[model samples]
Structure formats: structure tokens, C-alpha cells
Target chain A: MTVKQFFKSNAFKSLAVLLAIVIIAGGLLAIFNDLLFVSDEERFNRTIEKIYGGSATVEETLTITDENGTFDKGAVSAAYKMSDGNYLIHSSGKGGYGGDVYLWVVVIAENGKFGGIEKVLLDTSDGETLLGNFRDSFYENFTKHNDELVEGKYFGTSGSDVINNVVTGTTLSSNAMCNAVNTAIDFFKSAVLGEEVVSYTYLYEKYVDMTQTTIERDFAANSVTLRIVMQANGIAPSIAFDVTVKDGAITAFEATKPFVQQYDETKIDESLRNGTYFVGKTAEEIAAALPDGETLDPAKLEGLGLATGASRSSESFFRAAAFATANFEAFFAPENLTYASYVDFEQSTFTWNYTEGNEVKMHIVMQANGIAPSIAFDVTVKDGAITAFEATKPFVQQYDETKIDESLRNGTYFVGKTLEEIAAALPDGETLDPAKLGGLGLATGASRSSESFFRAAAFALSNYTFYLTGGEQA
Target chain B: MNKYVKTAVDGLITNNATFKLVLGTCATLALTTSAINGVGMGLSVTAVLLLSNVVISLLRKVIPNTVRIPAFIVIIATMVTILRMALDKFLPDLYDSMGVFLPLIVVNCIILGRAEAFASKQPVLDSAIDGVATGLGFTAALTIMGVIRELLGSGSFFGIQLWDFKIGFFTSSAGAFFVYGMCIALFTLISNRVEYAHRARKARELRVPAEGPLDAPGISAKEEA
Candidate 1:
């Protein structure tokens, strides 16, 4: 392309504009970054204030890893090599209860072996869910754990207070803190001891399942415990269970994971009977019994009711038993029933797609991109610009549905617009103010309908990164 | 509509970035847990939006259309970096609460949204007002949502615990949804009622002139006899 043509060309125009903007923006940002940046010591001292309630001197930053992998439990901050021959590290794990759990843990290094954790501070910056008596007493137990202590009391008010092997007042929230502490301990084992990390296909906080069954020869009892979590709806809250197998016979079966029941008690009483019926049955017999694919006949399930939702969940149990029987004979028995490195069940899933009847653009639905769990949306785009999305669904604070709905459908203001054009659409000669929004006294005031509109637009744009032809899915 | 009045109204409520436009959601959803936090985030955002809008309006003629998005982004980012660092040094509590979202303001759609749509086409004076107006709208929405969430979730107005009674779930994401929905509903209801009242009053005034005191020549032309 000629020099003159290049300036007019889309490629050059796009690139030149981008580069010029980058240069100017980057130069200024660098200076601000330097000026705004806090020194490591100050940052550490602040974290230490929450953790130790005293000033701490961070010696240096260090990296640790082993055979399984580097310590990937959480994001570990500076290693404060204290005067007491201890290293204080601040770490954050993604989830325990509702949000993240940040902790300050002190570890001691002994002659190249994994030293135990000395102190742990559960940073409540993002808060934790604690209710009732244990709310005050839970942290006291954590404070009781010092470096040399091996056995510590699992804090819980009652026997039923424990959830997913975590003993605490609240199941999910308190368990998150437990997981954070365990992550710190695991990091010590992997980094300091240089021990080979446990290799497994799946990992979870509550329980671990070996990819294959580890069959054991008769000793005490020729039995293996298997944990399987599944639910009817693809996005349904998972239902976790542990099925014990002894000599190819299903012995013990219980739902160990923390979850509220979807099926009523009567249905559970009737459906869970599938467990007893399958006991002493071979994997071949169990597999032979199942119809294959997503459907299984309840009549074939021996008096199990298909009308209630219990049968579907019960099928999850039988499926686990069958997989166990086959894999049991394959590896667990051959290895003399020895398996430790557990892996999680990573069930493969694909996006749910749809094409509205007689519509030009495609529509796809997915979960909303926030902590608003279970909330979902439908994104419809034509010629790359978003047409609209159904934002008032699943859950929302829709004050005026009619107005919000009207504004959402009126996204044509962004028709054929580039993502750039769509993002910035302020009117001409308008000196806008939040207070005077309704003051313009138009038919409608500051409309969240527009925000919802753009949210759908932005969501649709993001999905463009993972595109597929529009068609109906069976 | 009067152009200046319309613009200010639009910024605050008509086309608000937070409640209306839905831009800069990262900060809105993450930071608006308390009233002070909402105001703090709002000021920080206002600073960037005002400066970015002014800068972009001045450079509007110099910059090319094809590269407008990038140019706007660059300007916004610089402004955000400055705001972020300045806040970190001066207002550490707000800075700590905001965390990673401090830097994330660069990507906030509001700043760039204005730069591309308003500042680029409008004069410097108008663009500055647009920035402040929109910033205020964002601040208002956040503060209101924050107030609702904080009150219900903590049973306290602004960290002063009024009672032991608190809905712990309200402090979580699920709670945010409920509070956000309710706030939006209340905001729209009150705003619409006032707007409707104004329209009704205007219509009455117009009808009065048309009624012509019930004895004007327009209505009593034949009755003049």
C-alpha cells in the first residue's frame, strides 16, 4: 500500500492510533506507578499488623517447588526470615466460605526437612461466615496451634457442625479457612522437605478419588472407599457421596458432601434403595443393567420411581459403583490395593447454544460474570454489535421492569457500532451530572436499563472469543 | 430540552454510568460495601473521569478516528494510575478496601465511555461538566447501594453496630443482588414519580394558557356579543 493509502487504510489507521495511544498512556502510567508504589517493607508491615499485631522485617522473597509441582495452593507473599529462625509468609487462597481467605503463617526450616507451621492468622479482610457459639471460639482453637504441635482440636459446636471433613461453625466459610491453613502446610511439605508432590488427576478439599480403583487383597477387610459427587441438572449444586466396596460387594453408601437435598425424604427413602439392590453385584452386571447414555430406566432399577427426582440422583450412585468395579480390577487390585494421590472428577462440559426462531442473529446463554451465583443471561448479537440480552432473569433488582425492558430492547443506539463505538455513547454538547439526570425531567431518568443493556453487549462481545455457528442443539 | 440542562441531568440520572450505563462494574460491585467506601471510590473515579474527559476533548481534533478507542484508553489509564497511587499514599484505608480494583479503574468503561462519546465531539467546557455529572451519578448509585447493603447486612449504618441482628447473607454476593435490585427499584420509582409530577404540572400550565382564563378571545370569539 502507498504511504497515503496506508494512512487511510483500516490496518494502518487501527495500528497507528493504537501505538500512539499506547506510547502516551504507558509513559504517564509508568511515572504514576513509580510514585504510587509502596515499598515491600511497608506492605509487609501492614499485613503483619493484621497477622502478628507487631512490626515484622521481611528479609527476602523466595520460591519453592518439588516433584509434584511448585506450591500452587495459594498466592504466597514475602518470606520474613525473622530473628527467631522463622519465616513468616502471607498467603491467600481463592475460596473457603463466600470469598477468599488470607492468612499469615510462620514456618521453621529444619536441617532440610519439612518444618511444621508455628503460627497462623486468618485475615478477615474479606470477612468469613461464622454464626452461633463457635463464631467466637473457632479462632481460639487456631491460636492454640504452635510449631511443635501435631494434633489440634477441630473446632465445632456439635457433632453435626462438621462439613466436608472441616470442623467449624459454618461449613463452607469455616472450611475455606481450614483449606487455607492446609494449603500452607502442604506448601511447607513440598518446598522445604523437597518431597515429591502427590500426583492425581483430581483434587478437592473435602475428599479425593483415585482415577482408578485400588483393589485390595483380603486384609482386615478387602474394601475400598470411593467418593463421587454428581447432580441431575448440569449446573445443579453438586451432591457428594462415599460408596464403600468390599470384595466386589457394595457395603457402605452415604452422601458425605455438604448439600441441601433436592428430593423430599419420602423420595429419598424410596430411591436410595437402589444402593442395597446393587450390593454384591459385579461391575459387569451393573454396567449390563444400565441402558447407557444419559437415560436409565427406573423399572430396570427395580421399583425406583421416575416421577420423583430421586431416581436420577440414585443413578449417580450405581454409575459410580460400576466404574469402581471395572477400575478396581484394572489397577487397584494389581497394585495390591495401594493408592494415595487422589484426583478430582473433572467432567467435561460444553457451552449451551440456541438460535431464536426466525431471528438473524445467534443467542447463547451462560452464567452471569459476577458473584451472583446461579444467575444467567441470553446474549443476542447481529453483525458483531449486541442486539440485546434478557438481564431480568434468574435474579435481579429490577425496579421498573417495563422501563428496564424498554431500554434493553432499544440497544439499537449501538447498532453496527464497533465495540469502541458502543462503549462510549455520551450525547453531544451535554455536560452531564448525576444529580441533574432526572432533572432533565425526561420521560425516563438515569436508567439502569442501559447498564444492563451494555452488560449484555459486553458479555456477547466476550463470547465472540469463543464462537460457533448458530443452530439448534438436541 | 435545554442542551446544558439535559447534559447535566443525563450524567446524573438519565445516562448514569453506574446505575444507568452499567460501566465500571468491577469497582461498583466490589467496593460498594459501605457509604464511605462508595464516596471514596466515587471521588477517585470522578478525578480520573474529569481529567480524562478534559484531556480527550482537547486532543479530540488531533487524534485520528480509527485509533480513538486506544487513545481514549491511554488517557483514561494515565488518569487512573495517578488517582490510584495518590489515593494509596494519602487515603490508605480506601486504597486497601479498593485493592486490585484501584488499577482496574483504567479499564472502567465510564472514563473511556465519555472520552469516546462526549469529549471527542464536544468542546472542553462541556466535556468537563459531562465528566463531573456522570461521576456524581456513579457516586450516588454506589452510595445508595452501599447504604442498603451495609444497613441490612451488618445491622449497622456505617460500621456502628446498631444491634446484633444482621443478615449475614446480605454481606455476600447473593445479598448484593437483593440489595442492588431493591435500590434500583426504589431509585427508579422515586425518580419516575418526580419526573411524572413535573410533566403533569407542565401539562397543567399549558392547559391554563389554552383555557385562556375561560373568557379569552380565542375561546369567547362568538360570546364577545
Candidate 2:
């Protein structure tokens, strides 16, 4: 058709009308889009206004930096100094029941120092389905115990008044919320107020059987003094020690309370009571110096140049020193540790056997958390990814072993996942990402045992990568 | 009644978007998790429907038949975008609750259905009335379902905790389907009865026989009278 004829045709009219409508609609939308835009900062300010009951201008946006490398529980993502002198911190807490719990904590400033938390608002959550269980009063508890919170007292710990008010069904989310608030407070203390932020010594309680009562850090001396209380186990009475560690070596070890035999008053051997043998040894050296077995036999004590007469007393002292050393390493040099550190690597084994085709099957036996009768798994790998995982020996922890075994036996969670993907699926610490776990077909309730399975999978994958693929072993 | 009023009544009861015509069931089923969500979605749809219908009705003769569908869609999508932007800026809570379903209003069958079926053939005023009536019908239906589900599933009314007792099954997608199916059945039954009664009343008012034939095989009109 000629251009003039086409212009007069019905099809040409239809095209013109449609294009006109498109242009009009697009133009109208552009105008409205510009008119109704809500920027991120504006949205945050609105949220602040809603929570604080008044509009406050942003004085300045603060950059968040984890300077001390101690932000494991949670970290502040953004901070803002409001015109009203309140610091609004956007923080995320790890170890939530589902995943990370995000929160907006407003730290009220008074006299140029951290006053207390003004209010905490739940910004968002990953998979915390039971957030409804927490009421306004539960959050109000934070404000109620503000002074203690600023003084480095954490909720869910003994002697903290906030522990009593933690919501029952949503403990993980509650803990995560507390962590988020604490992270904000920690930032306020160190960055805002220029006060020394002390790390919690209670964090080291997980690495040892003994309780770390107090930890005093001498930053100038590059040393820490830990006071620990070893609980009475078997014939050993409860004993307390002042263990000082510097440069990863034990500088001082003194029994604050003398070791007394139960129902007997006998002077303990000098070598056992003095703690001089362990003064210069590091954690690895002390761990190596100890004789094998739960109880050091008389012959073994004699071999270590210890008087065998105080065998039980010597055993208690050495065990306490060993636990103190473990705690020191865990607190100071956490990078050197892994899930394998807690597991009895000597008892655990990883074997990669040849399979038909290119697939390789690995058998892993891991004994963790001092649980006897190691748990074992047979994993199949192809192209650096897990193809199948089956529990040959079920996890025999205090948890529901049957349910754990059933979930692990399903094993599709790890089937298509590579070593890095599996490791990144869950958080480093105790927090398990429920959304990721659900996507992987792992049950959140069986998280403790699931972690064991994950460790096993990691071990198998690392071995397969190292032996079969000539990759670096994790 | 005025023709405009009649058209609106018919849109609401006889040609209801949710229960009668069974259109826009996606938003109805998904967003009726709470009564507040139902109101928000219904009103948002109403605003979009009203604007799109008016625009389409005004341009009905100007647009050619071959490209009417695409033209209607572009108009409807524009209206929905404007509505979304307004809601996000002014009413963020409702916007967050509506979530992805807010944008999906662009393809909602109710707006497009009215544009094609009613607005294309009707006057601008009648088309606008039909939009409001149909949207209100949708709103009523969604609100009823939301009330039932929220009451049973969460034991709450519009986020107010009524009681702790709850049947968790009612909060699931399957529960939404069940509620939707039951509402459709009940609405059809009631509307059919009302329509039958109204027709009978109208016939009686005009002195016409309700059911019997005017002429029988053995009887003439005079004999039947």
C-alpha cells in the first residue's frame, strides 16, 4: 500500500489511537511517579516519627564499622544521629529462630553519653513466623531495664531481670531481638561515647565444662585474666582458679581456692597445687602435655613428672587448666577454631571411596560434644556437589534422634549443594536460617542434630574436593 | 427505577464480579486473609475499575475494534499504577499488606471484563456506576470471607484479638479455596431466590400469570380467562 493510502486505512487509525493512549498513559504515570516518590531516607524518617511520636530531622548519617571484630551475635548496618540527639541504629541480630532479626533501635543520648534505649521497632524478619507471640510489653522490657542494658548486661543470662520476661514460644527470636538491641548499645558505647567495649566472657562458656565467672582484659599488656569455677565432678571438689593468658601462653595460674579432698584434710602435692607446670604452656601445648584418658592413671602421672599420690587432685588441676586454655583460644584466636575443633578428630574419620561412574562416595564418622558412639554418614558427591547423603549411624544426642535421622535420610537438602553453599546455608554460630533450611528440606526443630549432619557433609565435601578434584581442603 | 440505578443494582446483585460472574477470584481469595486487607484491596480495585471504565467508555467510539483490548489494558494498567503510587505514598501499611497483589490489579479480570463487556457498549455514566457497584459487590464478598477466615483462623477481627481459640486450617490457602467455594454457592443460592421472587413480583404487579401458559392445547384464551 502507498504511504498516503495506508495513513487513511482503518489499521493506520488503530495504530495511531493505540500509540496516543500509550503516550498519554506513560506521561501521566511519569508525572505521578515523580510526585509520589518516597525515598529510603524519607521512609526511615517516617518510621522513626511513627515510633518516637514526633518528626525528627536526620542530623547526619553514620557509617557502621565492626572495628573490634567482636560483632558475631549481630551488627549494626546503619546509624543516624537525629536532630533530637537520639541515635537511630538499624541492626540485624543472628541466631534467630528462623534467621536474622532486623530491628531499629533508638538509643537516647543524655549529657553526650549513651542514656538508654528509647524504643525498638521490628523492621523485618526473615522467617520468624511466631513473631506474634511477642507483645508490646516484651519489647518494653528493654526500655525498662535500660541502665542494665547499657552496662553490658544481656537478656536471657542469669541475674538479668529481663530474662524473666522473655516470650515463651519465641525464645530464639527474643534472643535475636536482644542481640540486635545490644549491638546498637555496643556501638553507642564504643563509637559514640568513646568508652571501652568489653566483650562478654560468658561467650566462652560453650567451649568448656567449667564456668567463666569473670574475664579482665589488659589491652595495653595484650593479656586477659580469666576466673573460672570448675564444678565438682566425681571425687574432685569444686575449685576456682585465676588463669592469666598473654600472647596465647599461660602467664599465671593460681588456685584462688585450695583444692580440698572431700571429707579429708590432706595437703595436696606441690606439683599439683602450684600450677607451675602449666604457666608457660599454650593451649595446644597444654592439650598435648595432658595424658590420654578421662582419668590420668598413676603411671601416666609419674611419666609426666607428677607425684602419683595426688592423682585425683592433679587430674582436677590439669583439667581446669586445659579448659581455661581452651576458653582463652576460643575467645582470643577464634579464627583458628572450627566445628571440628569441638569434635574428637582422633575418633572421627573421613573416607572417600571410588564409585561407579564419576561419582565418589564418602563415609564420615564424627563424635561431637563429647557424645560417645560416633554418628556416621555415607555421602555421594559428583562435580564438587553433594548428590546424596544417608546416615549410616543415627545421631545419638539428647535431641530427638529418630526425627533427626529421618530428616537427614531425606538428604535432598544437600543433594545439589556445593561445599560453600552448604556452609553458607546456615549462620556461623548457633543461629539457623529457617528459610534456607526449609528450602533445603531440613527441619528447623532438628537444628542441633542437623548441624552435626552439616558438619559431616562439609567434611565429606572437603575431602572429596581435596582427594578427587585436587581442590584445597577446608 | 432509573436506568442508571437499575444497571448498578444488576452489577451488584445479578452480575456480581466475585460471586455471580466469578471474576477477580485471585485477589479475592489471596487478599481476604484479613478484613482490613479485604477493604484495602477492594477499594483499590474499585478506584482502578471506576477510572478505567470511564476512560474506556469515553474512548469507546474513538478506538478501533481490532486494537480495543490492548488499548483497554494500557488504560487499566495506568489507572492501577496511579492507584499503587497513591497508596504507597499515603497509606503504606495497606500497601505493604496488599504487596504484590496490588500491582497484579493490572491484569485483574474484573476491570478488563467491565471494559470489554459493559464500558465498551454503555454510556460513560452507566459504565462508571457499574464499576462502583461491581467493586462494592467484590468488597462485600471479600469482607465476609475475610471476617470468617480471620475469626476462625486467627481468632481475631481486623487484627483485634477476640479470643485465643483458633482453627489453624482456616488460615491456609486451602481454607481460602474452601471459603471462596462456600461463599459462591451460598451467594448463588440466595441471589437466585431473590431474583426469582423479584421476577414473580414484577409479573404479578403487571397482572401476568406467574407460571401457567397463556394458551393450553384444549383451551382458548377466553376459556382460560
Which of the numbered candidates is closest to the native, going by highest DockQ? Answer: 2
lDDT of 2 by residue, A1-474 (tens): 999999999999999999999999999999999999988877786787778667687799887666732365688888889988999888888768778888888898998977888888777673665454444557778788767665555555221123344565457778788778877888888788888775443332322232234444443365667666666655656666778888778888877664333522145555445667778876655554454313444553434555435555566666666666655533333112244443443333332333244455655555653332456677788777888887665444344565564646677667887877766655664334556564555544566567767777776665564434222233
Q: Individual DockQ of the candidates?
A: 0.18, 0.23
Provide the global lDDT of candidate 1 against the true structure.
Answer: 0.55
- Badly placed stretches (over 4 Å) of model 2 are A39-41, A55-61, A65-77, A81-86, A91-103, A107-474, B159-167, B202-225
Candidate 2 whole-model C-alpha lDDT, 0 to 1: 0.70
Clashing pairs in 2: A95-A431
Candidate 1 Cα outliers beyond 4 Å, as residue runs: A1-17, A49-87, A92-102, A106-150, A153-177, A183-474, B1-6, B21-31, B85-96, B99-107, B207-225
Candidate 2 lDDT over B15-56, as tens digits, reads 888888888988887778778788888899989989999999
State fnat for each of the candidate structures.
0.45, 0.55
Candidate models: Cα lDDT each: 0.55, 0.70
TM-score of chain A of each: 0.34, 0.43
Consecutive 10-residue window with the lowest summed lDDT within model 2 chain A:
A203-212
